[model samples]
Target chain A: MIAADLAPGAVLSLECPTITRTALALYAGASGDHNPVHIDIDACRAVGIDDVFAHGMLSMAYLGRLLTDSFPQQSVRSFEVRFTAITPVNASPTCHATVTDVEDGHAHLDLSVQLPDGTETLRGRAVVSLP
Target chain B: MPVDRSIIGSRTPAFSTVAERGRLRFFAQATGQTDPVYTDVAAAAEAGHPDLPVPPTFLFCLEMDNPARGSFLSDLGIDVRTILHGGQSFRYHAPAYAGETLTFWTEVADVQSKKGGALELIVRDTHVERDGAEIATLTGTIVVRDPRAGR
Candidate 1:
């Protein structure tokens, strides 16, 4: 949707499957982040973590997909996220965005990634240019 | 040990990568992005993009192409096991597409200690450029926890 068509408070959402160890392993290979905490259960325990968790980038990537799917790629001018909490293994996450502002040819969105329990693990915003 | 504050402002040697379509497709699929514009040239062209558009946040992955990617943490004597992904941000000046060669230059932007030096935060900013023109700026933070703090 174009910025002109977006109204403040309009929302877009996407539900992602449970984050699996295999997915994290694939992302490790794809993204070149070999951090074992994201893929190795033992490594997580060694580091004082209860278990391996999803990479923060992986959730950010989901938020990216939410934006690209709603608007054209060239229209996105900025995307940002702050990792707030650990996304545990096998947790299904949902990404949500609300049109916080639309003006000067830009649609500003407040973005978030939340676990099934409604705990927000990632939060941020994006600015998409109008076509 | 906390990361050395003196490392702030240190810059990494510039590096470049050709945005290949295959890699873009792999990233799109890996992230569960079903958008055709990210994987199909025609679909991207139909959407007004010159070519397959680089997915947002993928620039963070590209920054990893720097051969000295891990040296920053190593230089601080921090073990990889103790690090946590803290946060990340990207600002786009222009859209990047597949097959374009983009250059990246990164600098350590900030460093701070928290919880009585039990944790450290390192922030880095990377400038993404193409043909001498700016494309995007990526900023990321990594948090390192001191395992011996409580002991």
Candidate 2:
């Protein structure tokens, strides 16, 4: 149970919940990240953005699920992400993991959250202990 | 206008928050997490956790528990309207669980201006501790675009 049969070249993926206006609202309140750019259309327009977008943290949270689903939560030693693009509302994001290295009882993996159109919303890395 | 480099090294007072179950479950639901261990302690215990393990990235939510969270930006005359999240990272030295009281404090690690001063980014490192021992560190970048920059 401590290991996930992972190897240096293994690839893992999971489709996350499609982002919607309702999901944005719920996240805004629950995470206390009430950035109006994520929930209010008028607010988005005020900033010249045509439509509200998903919070970057929301995408990062979904990416975390990829790790949890594959390995035990406690096994995750580090997680990181760079916000590269905006995830417009209604976009379905997919989380991906590719093992880059396995050593010293841990697996180092490259991670990403990408949209259906192939836009990578987030990219980064993670280190997880196998034992 | 670029963010003043002097702001680097500014630190926030240490604050504390409890990882309550209700908020954890709410966050889990909001993220569309179907895993029962994140919501049910019994399931978490069955999974060998002492309690509901703090889901990855949830600590960022708890980091917002710093009561003066907004002061850092507000005090700098930065309009919340012009801000965006650039990127962030986390390193966990130990697993955090629900019901544990964790203390958090942040320091401005660096400040930079990019895209010809159209964007200013503030890098912060937040330290999360429990029982006086460090459990996690979160590094985040807050981007503030000059509203007048006109893209």
Candidate 3:
């Protein structure tokens, strides 16, 4: 567990489970985001997309896990993400956080989630209080 | 139809909701959160929280508690089917716990047309509060793709 003393260039990562349609369905129910394009195959076809894709929030959740895995829950001052691309069903997403600056008991991080196909699905930043 | 830039300064009526434990647990498990602090009240207290601390980005879900959530788009004559999640950001002022009634008020912060009006972006800023105290601020972007553009 990295409890501060982290340099500006410190890097932390989390390998999320291979996202599945079942997971997406559960996430929709749990998060209450029932957008059919995320879970319904027909909706995807109507939009010229072949299959349902993972929710952008799901990948953001994984990035949260990465921070919680290293720092205390309270230490997480803030987290935010941009939905860059869709994480299609069955795609494996890896979350990465690189510390860009450390100051006054906080560390600012550059965050991202990427698939193996070289697609960066989500990009974001976070601020964590240092111990 | 292009988004009305006049809607940029509009604010949604405030709405509130409680972070029920059962749903919090469900969300934790669904997101593969290994930390028990999000589900186990005792563990959370030990971690210096009065109760289960709301997970990161969970407030975005809570924002949907705005029963008029879809009304914003409808009022602007935008079809819900033409939208996509563009992006989101959050800044926490304090840790919110399960069972606390959190209030949300959102403002349409910005509106933009891109790709020669083929796509429109609506940016929203939501203030998360509890007992009139700031809990967090969630900013999200919704992209509206013009179904007929460039066709």
Candidate 4:
């Protein structure tokens, strides 16, 4: 979609599947970030965390999905996120983005990932160029 | 154990890796990115990309290819068990695609203490390039808790 065609406050959303232990393990292998806190429940307990949690990058990846699914990858000029909270196992998360501004063929979006209860796990923004 | 601020300017040797198609596909699937441009070259071409485009944030994963990836923490006397991913950011100058050999260079950007020295934060910036042309910059912050602080 062209930036000029996007309206300010236009929001796009994606419902992510429930995070599972198997998925975490898969991400561990795929991303080569074998942080035990994301895959080993026993290790998580030892570290004073309640249970194995999703990788913050995983949440960022979900937000990336929201952008790539909408704009072509090449059009994405910048994407960034800050990990705000832990996404617990089995948490059903969703990604949302609102078109905040469009200027000179560039569209800016405010993005976030949150649990069903509205607990935000990640917050971010992206700038995309319209083709 | 407090992190020594002296290592803030340290840099790791540069490394390079080819963005293999299979690996890109696996990452897209793992991240639940259903975009075909990330997994199919033809689809990517149809979408105005030269080839399967590397998804954002995936560069952070590629930066891990550095042979000394784990040495930074060990050299700082940090235990891997006590660390958490604090934050991450990326700036893209150009799109990276599958089959491209991308080089990465990383340097420790900053260090700080929180909670009366119980938690230490280390920030690093990685530069990515293809054939000497800049592709992206990855910024990451890792937080480590001193076990001696006893929570």
Candidate 5:
């Protein structure tokens, strides 16, 4: 695992690797967050959304997965994220995290969820404590 | 039927409890969180927290429908197995620490359905109060997926 030593402003991007509806549903089953906006396309269109979207937690969960899998001192101290927009499933979602600041054995990251067109679906930040 | 927007300001009944240290440790371990402050009370106090603070995600285990934690959506006629976790965002008025009695409530914030899918937004508000003073409010947004559609 790489150390959470990215200089402030360093950025990294990850593409959603076909985290299909089935995978999402399974996560919901395990996590108990069964929301139809993430599953019902019709429901999504009713809200003027282009397509069914992934759960906000699901997005953050992926980021959490990234933190645990890639960064050093994997345990997250305090995580804070905000959703600016919804991520559509029609195209692949690219997730990126930019190192914003580091202090007290923690690194703060500016994160984003975006589409193939580079349209941002969500933006947030997290403070992860290194081991 | 349309979801009532007036309920936004209403607060659900609060449930209170002190998290067992063992359980808190287990939760931190289960979520793969290894921060010493979460695992050690002394470390937490040294960091200025009154006690070991549970991970923010740890609340999901308590509020969300888990067999042991009880079901939050089953009464709504929602099948626990068919749903998908949609989104979660939090506005922290204060940081949550362990051993504090937390009074929590949930309200159905927004419910919108589309041709492709439906999204139910539920907000959970938890207040960590001590002697009537306000501590923190944890607002969570949950989305449950509809099962009848093709992914």
Candidate 6:
């Protein structure tokens, strides 16, 4: 598995536009988490935000996509992440991942999500088990 | 007096967890996934999948009892709502296709104190199989924290 071959400090980053509405709709539909802060722009702005925000899981799913794509040969055995900040919608968001450690058949990665303004939106880690 | 760390090693019993088809469809629809592999069995085979397959996150819908249910953590004075999603990990030996009954077992691995608050790590694992063939195993972590005390 490529996960077994990754060296510590290996990093991957991607910058992409944020589809806030689509993501919130998707997560709300998928997880049944229909919180207004994700979909209601007016509601979001009521609390001093520019626009609606993406669901934490949507950003997490992007990390999931990263793990599955990076080590296609390996089945992800474990993953963990913390939502540091809100991911704003209708804007661009950059996502990155770095290999932090590999031991006992597990590859650990430090991940982050950022906005164009250089705001750090999320930070977390994911571990994959090698085949 | 400090709590006993011995309870961390307790294991939960394996049991049959229901996978509701309608809910799976709803979840798939919500995610904007339209693949026939997830909605139709025959189409899944036509697409080369063994059976109808749900998305990776589908496992969360199944509410299984903790092996240490009503014990340990809560007994030690932990609040469930203060807990947040730590992360999820899954291993697929084979695709867990739809229409198949799946069984899973879980256990608590460890718990430790973090600088800001107590981070209670509970590992809930599920091993899925069909007709004696192992299909997948998922290990998920739920991090319980005292949100009121954290930074």
Q: Order candidates by lDDT, high to low.
A: 2, 3, 1, 4, 6, 5
Each model's TM-score, in the order given?
0.94, 0.96, 0.95, 0.93, 0.55, 0.59
Tell me how far the alpha carbon of residue B53 in candidate 2 is from the true structure, in angstroms, after superposition. Answer: 1.1
lDDT per residue as tens, model 6, B1-151: 2334675766666556546667667655654455555667687678676665655556544433333444545686754344445555555565555566776556566555555435656555556666667666666565665544432
Ten consecutive residues with minimal summed lDDT in candidate 1 chain B?
B142-151
Instruction: Looking at model 4, give its docking quality level.
Output: medium
Error of 2 at A118 (Å): 0.9
Candidate lDDT scores, in order, read 0.87, 0.89, 0.87, 0.85, 0.58, 0.61
Whole-model lDDT, model 4: 0.85
CA deviation > 4 Å runs, candidate 2: A1-4, B147-151
How many angstroms is residue B99 displaced in model 4 relative to the true structure, after the best TM-score fit? 1.2
Ten-residue region with minimum lDDT total, candidate 6 chain B: B61-70
The candidate that wins on TM-score is 2
- What stretches of model 6 exceed 4 Å from their correct place? A1-58, A62-131, B1-4, B34-36, B40-43, B63-77, B116-118, B123-125, B129-134
- What residue runs in model 3 are displaced by over 4 Å at the alpha carbon? A3-5, B147-151
Q: What DockQ do you compute for every candidate structure?
A: 0.72, 0.72, 0.68, 0.67, 0.14, 0.21
Task: Give one digit per residue, the lDDT tens place, for model 3 in A24-128.
Answer: 999998998888878899976776667788889999999998988888767888888888887899999999999999889888899999999889999989999
User: How does candidate 2 score on lDDT?
Assistant: 0.89
TM-score: the better of candidates 1 and 4? 1
User: Candidate 3: TM-score?
Assistant: 0.95
Candidate 6 clash pair list = B12-B67, B52-B98
In model 4, the fraction of reference contacts reproduced equals 0.76
Q: Give the higher-DockQ candidate: 1 or 5.
A: 1
lDDT string, candidate 4, B42-130, tens digits? 98889888888888888988887677888877877777778878889888998888889999999999999988877889999998989
